[model samples]
Target: MMQRRTLAAGVAAFSALWLAAPLATAAVETPDALVKRLSADILETIKADPELRNGNIARISQVVDNTVMPHVNFRRMTSAAVGPQWRQATPAQRERLQQEFKLMLIRTYAGALKQVSDQRVVVKPLRAAPEDKDVLVRTEVHGKGEPVQLDFRLENTDGKGWKIYNLNVLGVWMVETYRTQFAQELNKGGIDGLINALASRTIAADAKTAKSAQP
Candidate 1:
């Protein structure tokens, strides 16, 4: 299993990438175009904004929650990451899980967003038919190091358009990696155990932020 810190870093990089990809409602907007637009725009925005590149966690997370969450199917992501335990979760339990998981991810990635530099995202070709409800949009983040592969699996929900549910970073699916971690907790305790683990992580992350902001 991937270590929690490694997974957190990888997912944070993904969060920065996807924050660039809000859904475009234009009639001519294809997944490719949408990604292209967001990637370029987000890069430009970051390049011009010192706050985002300077480790401002509150502003970074605000940008993510306000601009990126709308294009994400986080409920689907949280449920899928929980695997079969999702079906067994009570509605309230599921909500708490999603809330805690979202908090953990956003905060973890908030610091990572400062690492965004001259990296450029290149969207790969789309292989899906026009009528396809689901699609995989591949891309690579090229910077100083070898290009890191970052891809998104998006589903065209009824009226929501294309919303991301999964991400592949360096060939590892985000949800799958978390699924293994979550499964371990589930096996040791149960759904509540898993939820508690997520909650604890979020709280710890918040505490770290609180400490950093202290004198």
Candidate 2:
């Protein structure tokens, strides 16, 4: 049962990777195009680097920093996910939470990337108005098993071009999941409490990684 659960987690992680692949191919012509282009670049690096295939946490972080962070709208996502608490937080607190949340996601997703193997993603055709500020790029992840839908929500920015704010895996929105969790945390301990919790979680995860690496 334990092994089965682990395998299930692995599959879920790979599904995310499968979903992210098409974002690389997104052309600058459209938001969807830019998403595809970015996703493709990240996945291409994963495919090219045999060391990254082993799923090292550090390697995954490097990939995210280099290819993914540049195109993500962390501030917008943090504010939206935290909802009203975002306004309550001091500028410093909000910045801290945003930074921690971003790192948490990168670390979490990086861990998942290790599980992806023998899977490929297919980007569905998208049509949206050029004037539209927000658009969803729909794609599918295919493996030896059934295909699952992955949707990426992107917003156009004057300074940064297209930036991703949300991702849907199998019809589940990642931002919504975080929102619910953050609300619960805030209710239990307030905004500072929630920030501390996220910071602690990151520390614990990093410690675990370090311990595992010790000879």
Going through the candidates in the order shown, the clash numbers are 0, 15
lDDT of 1 by residue, 78-100 (tens): 99999998999999999999888
Residue-by-residue lDDT tens digits, candidate 2, 88-179: 88999988998889777765655555555555557788767767888888877555455666778888867347778888776678889899
For candidate 1, the lDDT comes to 0.77
Q: Which sections of candidate 2 miss by over 4 Å?
A: 1-27, 211-215
Ten consecutive residues with minimal summed lDDT in candidate 2?
Answer: 18-27
* lDDT for each candidate structure: 0.77, 0.68
